[model samples]
Target: MSQTPPSCPASVEDVFACVEEHTRPLSVEAVSLESALGRVLRERVIADEDQPRFDVAAMDGYAVRADEEAEWLEVVGMLRAGDWQPQQLEAGQAMQVATGAALPCAGLRVVPKEETERTGNQVRILRRPADTCIRLRGQNFRAGDQLMAAGVRLNAGHLALLASVGWVRPVVTRQPRILHLVTGNELVPPGQAPGPGQIRDTNTTLVAAFLSEWGLPVQSFRVGEDEAEARTFLAPHLTGNQPPDLLLISGGASVGEHDFTRSLLEYYGFRLLIHRTAARPGRPLIFAVRNGTVAFGLPGNPLAHYVCLNLYVRAALQRILGVEGGLAFAEGFLTEAWNPGRSPWETLCPAVWKLESGKAQITLLSWQNSGDLTPLRHANAVARLPGGEQPLSAGSKVVFLPTHPL
Candidate 1:
């Protein structure tokens, strides 16, 4: 391991730009209609047939041919929804039609049942019906109409439209296969009592949850503190027949003696893109790529892990999948004053915010340090505080990134 100190940390924007420039969108795959929700569409979905497919009744009424002064008409037939057979409507004749039923005769106007009196196949018109109630063929959409454009993230409504257009499966961008390696002999699995100088392995859970939220598959493994053991455990995964598209290493990314993640990745021919970022809570974040697979060495601290995953990991995934990614920021006023620390790095402080009378009111959570995760339980957002020693007062406008939408 040739270890001069790692390269100087880069700005957050520069890191994002570098990752975006290096990562290419994954190829396409065919997924079942039911499984396509939340996946990015790779192909434009065009209508296979016109919506409605035929002229149909839009209301429950009587289908009749308009005449100059026809006050009474003979009831010839009845049509309900899904009835497609054609029925003729002669002069002075009408047919009972239900909503969504195909019109029995061409050029016939439907008079709502409430506008006419009906008794024993005989009907009396009470009012003149305006325009026809028949929904024309292709009224909603034509056969060649584009229903959904490429690169759109499929949602419930989009799936409904696809089903309506007879798409049982959709072409979507293939989601990356992610494998996580959480290291540290001092970390014990959750549900087990931690020994002295030990803590629960929360980073794995955090990384897994974030990956699931981003619509990626999660496969994880636990490794011990030995550098040789860690290297041996990860070597097969790096050069397998079906290696993961992305590798996430949690806990061993910093400059400590046990922080061999970067060195191991370098040994495997992975080129480091950015070894560190000028951001608080996650300055040791490392990004590298090799053989078309990207690896992110996230910090071990739980709070730092959360921030780096949200900021950098999420951005890399979005670029790889060709989907809209990055933190969505909203302008809001701080409910209390905040004094930025003396560190030169930009700080991301946890906050809880809500809309009050259409205005965003934000309150900074009581944060002890980046190692503390308790404050995040009540925080839905993080306020980006500048590096200078200025104290931002209450009611000051600040931009915040929501962990979940407000």
Candidate 2:
């Protein structure tokens, strides 16, 4: 007799809490600024020198003493950017200053060229200078000031700031290595025609691509339906020198006769922290950790695998890296009605979301099932629907998780 699949016993919030409680940031390594993008900072960065080190002109204008009331002044010299030598400004003397050029002396104010008229070295002030147009020394940032705090994910802006602060090499958390195991008897490699009940293995490729995009080192291997063979294949990854930080097992997570992923994991001393989650399209998700190696047994369906990876696997990676992780949710109104079945688990419906006339709107796609991947092509976001007897109507407010960076 076939056994019934076990119901998901963990809520979404509970699963997240469990991940946070168990996961710790990986060890730190010094990486050059050129290769530090998207890496989490392990040490706080301090400014080595004051930004603008000296007072500089904010506009292309003439620098003069604020106390001078002379309507006309003689331009003694010109100061271009990078001219560090100080030039004295007499009571009626002025200097032509370019934007970013250091001010000649203290109490000097810049008069924009547009507000003054010049004939050769002589210039006439057209209007009273209300603004100084001067960037004071250390105005942007002072020396020894905190440039970036620890635990920040370095992006383009962060990298630029680090470079500005003279940090050519910054300490960052090391990326976790991943090993993907594709298991199934009826699965065939891609680019080949499937015979009989066999289907091409797409989950491995999908998981590998996701890991690669995240800049994580990943390796994939195939395992047949036999539990003994699967154990042998996973044995090398479970323990040894340079073992992977995460083991991603595709397929064989459910309570089916052919499903041997959970049993094999147990045999290898993997302790299950999360057996399942109360979320659709990923109900059979499994998370286990042993000896600092984390493993996830994802479902066989393509779309289900994608959803679970985004929800669970990504969370685990963020936790291990000591970086904050969560889907970017935006508020939008439904353009059409959607009513999936009422269950205890929340439903996430794929949808196309766009901004029209400065207003955000989302339309639910025509979904077939978890196995269908066609709908994902048109889906840029996933709309969240609470589990209840009531169906969502058009114009109802909802929150959507974006698939791509918005």
Candidate 3:
């Protein structure tokens, strides 16, 4: 008799609740400014000074006091970005302030370069119509104000903001370390010759690449064959001197006789959080944790693994690390309807094209076998379908999660 799949767990909330109960963040480490990219901030970073640091010029022109008679003032001295003016602007004199130069207190207005004329130390202001080009001190942000709250990832923009606020040295949480294990019996290492029935190992490479994109470094390994050999290979990596913040195992998550990833997880002292989900292609996904490290068991198929890695596994990792705002999902309407051969639940297929009309049109990638990876390259989004007996019509609205989380 066919065994019924484990109960659906009521909803996605229940699955996440179980996942949250088992997983926790890894220990924190300190890194320098250059090494802080992709790491989360552990503490709130306050600005020590204003962003502009002074009332400065927003254009390369003359800085003069704003009054009815101050409009035609003469340029007394020039102030470049790094130079300072020893004398402030007098009643009839203005200082030449370049873009980003600090403005003296006597200057209250700035005329843009295109709107002024200069000869020697003298200048004529043309467009002093209003207070248009003065970047006032503390206008963008003030000193002692919270610039970036904790849990923000340090990206290029964040770095620029921090530098503007005089944060030469800042504190950031260390990137989460991952231990990746690829398990299969018919795999061959890259660059090695593969005979019939053997395929090159792509899982390890893909997993490592994906983790690296998220600012996480992976200590990855590969194992082959059944339960005993797989468990033995993983024993060292999972229990070694540098145990991973997250353990990712690809393949051997299904119910086949050789699929020992789930069973052996219990052997290695992990509590199963969720054995299955309602999503297609990655329905057999599993999550577990031991000693505060999350273990994610992904489907063996490359495309399926690709989907789950971004959707479920990434979510679990971000939750523990206190990282926020990195999750990405897209919305599109279905341009073409599809039906998988023999599944009760709706399958999330890779979208081939998003139409000019803003509709998502896709069919199963040609010859899309579970293990085939050709579809992954052409796919950019995972189109969703609600559970129902009737087939969906074209142009139907649906939600999709992008494979690239950025």
Candidate 4:
């Protein structure tokens, strides 16, 4: 709280620093791996025992002494996978083993059954394997080995790895309670037909969909610009023992007469840290904190909401989960020419970044204004363009932030 500048408008980097300073990792909890998807891990996943603990056959073949020089050998026994009776194989003896069957003894080579002609219990060797064809013990991993480190976001593959080690439950960061309220009397439900001087509400749907990607649950509502109406919706979450960890207020972040986001935050014991930012589409950004709860006043524009959610708000979520990197920026080259108008602040141009010919390529989208929602459906990234009247040509190197999964 004290580290944040109260009056001055902050740059993107300055705001990032302030958020990092104020944010803290949330508490940890143990949950089954089945329910751990999309949750950040808080503990290391260690191997309980050696992988491939026993030497087993990698193919279906005859287990014979590697040094055997005889043209034919006696098939003493047949061993399939899960049958672990081991017997020493003499120079003239062979044991038929299925794939994944343990080797009868050391110094044994597996000759694939396809290379041998078998008649009842007797078999004739048509060819010999060049190698042992055996998977050695502890080949994959050993006991006590660190398979996965902390701060990892769990996915299907991670869960599978945990299951391989018999670790059914993993410790991960608890999901934070998020509350979002979109203010503006001019906003109407997307389902309802709008009257004159009003538009359908898209912020609610956008915010809900954005948060759903992380598997986080959020309670969102469209409240009137009046403080009393907003407080009534906030009463249930505020009066209870468990209050929202993060609160987002969309629209009214500016300095208009109805712009009461600042006043609303102050009235709720939240100390304003940032009033605005030096970034396009998100200049009227507001940030505040009270106790351990964090709040944001997001610009009502559809594109601005998209930018702030994926950029700044995502950084706060990462900090709360102890993620290693705060905000990850990827490098790409422009696939098409871009004529961006000049602006004093950096512009986060909606773009589509995809792999083409093994190269990261970005194509900036066209939007009439900041409130335009046309480009969002096609944008998978946000190109960070430096402020100027610079025209970006095709194949120009640019740095971008991925909005979708890499």
Candidate 5:
């Protein structure tokens, strides 16, 4: 039986919970460490061996007994990086060790070259500074120590750490197959000059860039306003063995006469779970599913698309990638007095923020309406303003989410 779509939730946070119930993590695969960035790690990465493998010098200095009372010690040997020579250091002896060279013995201190004067065969300890410039074995991590837990998203630093532990090919959740359809006869490509009653489409580039943050690829196309033709164009994709894992249709999500996203998804056997949201600019958002594939019908307004993509669609992608937990909102203080105006619904306003002395200070940007996209250029974060009429003063605490791609 076809399921009826639910009514809009009272809060934007509930919308996140509704879509999360229908999705699960995609299958996992083994990929090279180089290609693992932005991919959620599926296995526990442990230290293959003690990090550094041995006691190595942190810098070029003389390795000597910390309590050596010799006026001048013999230069036993010169050790460079990758050279491991274990020679016992007596009370009157020292080793000239280069940066990253293995220490000859324990109970030794590294006197920096700046604090010592070296002669041809004998070096004089001009000053015996109490400093140990050695990177001890197991200091960073010990053998079998858990370096990364499952479900951690791998970044460049995480990849390097994995490679150092011999994880050349790490298992990660596969990225979802996304099919994007832009619906509207009045929409034209960004390069083309728009005629009367037509506007250039910006949702394609916007959606692509957002997906690239997680290294996911999107297949995009334009479907006209005619519901029948749009169904015919998308019917094959839902039937084939390699159907998209997630479907996104830009525009046609409202209650207008031309809005057909809800009916079209039903005809394709998709169960509409959500038809609207309680957030400003993104109220007409649609979330549906067919079997395991998730779908979202975004509003035609450019800013609405941006807002929905950042909030709801992002939540779905997180579940599919096996990233644990829900959408996290951080607290920030407002830098200026502003108001999103009086609205019964939650407002997801765009803003720019920076950390000052470890505290987030936000400056909310303004927009004429949901159709406005110019303000997004200055927005690096999204601020959640609860329904109220009072203007927020400077340094008022507010919740926000950073919109960084990485």
Candidate 6:
């Protein structure tokens, strides 16, 4: 009989530290600016040229020499958007200029379209002393200035900025290639009828969706049956040329006779950093590394596996891809009292926040069960309360990780 591994402190920080110490940045990739969103920056992106590259009009108006009084003159030329050449504006002369058009000349003022009377080749100044609405070159940014620093996850705004800065293709941190293996003898895919003593494999689907949401890439995902079948299926992947940066195993982490993930790791010479943690729902978590890939063994419970991944694995994967804190964390007020039970690891539960008459109040979700996923549907923040803290009271302040706005 195999002896069960000892349980250890389930501090989220300790788990993260272990992950950080073992993982390294993945390779870099050059993708088109249009598709760079959510990927980490492999290198600092400097401004290629000043935004607006030249003095440009900010509105449709008459381009005139601010130093001269122009009552009327021939509109010798028309400047529209994308017109790069600067036109000479002589004294007593005005040119028809459109928004985003290059300034007719330096020291020129603009008479807004609403403030001017326009005829063929001539414009009457309806207002005076209005300086040219010229956007100066490099006003937004200068060449060689850092536009986006390395290790930042790109967003839609970043993509627009990159395109505006004239980068067709930019270097970004390569996607983290991962292999997911789900093991169980009594599990079937969703939508399939389960036989006696069998259930649907919800963990597999949830894990896939979670990884996709994290912006990481998956190379392969296979379902493993018994020990022999699992070992055989994983053999080729372990020795393949393109080995995954991380190997995540779902289920089969317990000491059941059918569970083979732990034994398989030992057979392949992996050093397991953590075999268990004193936490609810996901106590049988395991982490290991072999050769260079980080291997993980998550509990079979769907909710528990997702919680562990969110609290630890996701952050670690981001760090491995050279990303900073995976997401943002904010502070909120506890609306009602909270009572934390004894556990080595802190529990992160959903909390809803609203204005109570005048003050802000945060309350736990309706379903707080470890096996329930309904609570997440209404959860806006993951409240972090100390494991051994005294019973929390209303109006107490707590730090929480906010959910990304939809």
Rank all candidate structures by their TM-score, best first, as comma-separated numbers. 5, 4, 2, 1, 6, 3
What value of lDDT does candidate 6 attain over all alpha carbons? 0.74
lDDT of 4 by residue, 239-301 (tens): 688988899999999999889888777777787889899888898999888887889899999
TM-score of 2: 0.91
Name the lDDT of candidate 4.
0.86
Per-candidate RMSD vs. true structure?
2.9, 3.3, 3.8, 2.0, 1.7, 3.3
Task: Give per-residue lDDT, candidate 5, residue 90.
Answer: 88
Off by over 4 Å in 4: 1-6
With a 3 Å backbone cut-off (N, CA, C), the pairs that clash in candidate 3 are none
lDDT of each: 0.82, 0.82, 0.72, 0.86, 0.87, 0.74
lDDT tens digits by residue: candidate 5, 1-406:
4487665453686777777788999999999987888999888987879988998888788999878888688998999998878888988898998888989888888888887888897988888655587888889989988999888889989988987888999999997899999999998999999999999999999999999877899999997889999888997888989899999999999999999999999888888888887778898888888888999999989898888888888888889888877777799999998765677777899999899999999998899999999999999888998776877789889999888643
Provide the clashing-pair count of each candidate structure: 0, 0, 0, 0, 0, 1
What's the lDDT of the predicted structure labeled candidate 5?
A: 0.87
**Which tens-of-lDDT digit does each residue in 213-318 have in candidate 2?**
6777788888888999987877776767877788889999988999988887888877777777777778787887777887889998988887777667777887
lDDT of 1 at 1: 29
**lDDT minimum window of 10 residues, candidate 1:** 1-10
Q: Candidate 6 has which clashing residue pairs, if any?
A: 75-121
What lDDT score goes with residue 205 in model 1?
82
The window of 10 residues in a row where model 5 has the poorest summed lDDT is 1-10
Off by over 4 Å in 1: 1-6, 65-71, 87-91, 105-108, 125-134, 324-327, 356-361, 404-406
The alpha-carbon lDDT assigned to residue 364 of candidate 3 equals 40
